[model samples]
Target: MAPLIVNEIISPDTNLLIAFLIGIGFGFVLEGSGFSSSRKLAGMFYGYDTTVLKVFFTAAITAMVGMLFFSLFGWIDLDFVYINPTYITSAIVGGVVMGVGFIMGGFCPGTAFCAISIGKLDALAFIGGLTLGIVFFTEGYPLFEEMYKANYLGTPTMNELLDIPRGVFALGLILMAFAMFWVGEWAEKKFPREEY
Candidate 1:
């Protein structure tokens, strides 16, 4: 079984088939989870519905814990996994831009796509705006390229930066997620909104 598992080869056709299946599952789950509703997603910022926050944090923590467990068990190769190369300036600037866009547009890229797929006209307009924003970014890329590429710290994780073990970081994240979940539950009761 170990030999079969380690030596298993996926043909291009099989890989594409698996990719399609995974994509379909992802789309179905997103739609079912109310992610296809921009208002539901935007409600996180308004303290109306906190489902988005709960789902997102839960997913993040789950993935973090799973990856850590996989590494501990030697089931996955951590070294082969790609990590984001830190560019301090770009990270700050990009985060600020994303925050502003979220506040103004009330939809992030993935949720906007999900909403668009479900025939939300607002999401369609948001997508149009996103395209324009992308075009503008591309046209202005040269101007920002230097700053964007500056202050590079190669693939540094929070564990490496803070001198903490990955498991400890993952555990902390889980605790934080639980705290957020509790707060989200309270907020939902404290500030209830009508369901659409």
Candidate 2:
């Protein structure tokens, strides 16, 4: 049975410790993959390096398939999984903001932290700006609260929303990820960038 914490098989402190260890490993992988470089990260948008796309796509597919198999094998309880509630308006706005920030800063939050660990000054600035953005958002929460809560789409899984079986949805996503990887490889060749 998975979700040991939810099932009360593991204490909350142990769960948190596990999460911290996983986070360290994940950060190490990110840094090893050259995610600490702002130019490399920004290359995703420039069509010069598609490694970012491939890495993230592969991760998504892996997680999706892993969870599907886990559920099928009764190793994990799907009902114990948490799905974040969808706030359509806030989601759209947040995506746009994050996209813009990614382009300008050349690092998402996770990657920024990775860069900071490697002593990147640019990443330090990015973190400062990110902190300011967070402060601004929190201070202005009351003003944005209405817009944030506008679209109240209750938590719904993709398969449930599309009225398809989980296996079918996972299959479709895996196929799509393959196609995207093909395109990404082609783009990298078409828009080649110097080694970082």
Best by lDDT: 2
Once fitted onto the true fold, the runs of candidate 1 whose alpha carbons sit more than 4 angstroms away are 1-13
Give the per-residue lDDT of model 2 (tens digit) for 30-127.
Answer: 99999999999999999999889999998898998898888888777889887889999999999999999999999999999999998999999999
lDDT of all predictions:
0.82, 0.93
Inter-residue clash pairs, candidate 2:
none
lDDT of 1 by residue, 1-196 (tens): 1222343555566767877898788778788889888778778878889998988787788788887887788776677677878999999999998878876777888878878887888888888988998999899999999999999999989988999988888888888888999999888888889888
Best by TM-score: 2
User: Candidate 1: minimum summed lDDT over ten consecutive residues — where?
Assistant: 1-10
TM-score of 2: 0.97
TM-scores for every predicted model: 0.88, 0.97
Where is model 2 more than 4 Å wrong at Cα? none
RMSD value for candidate 1: 3.2
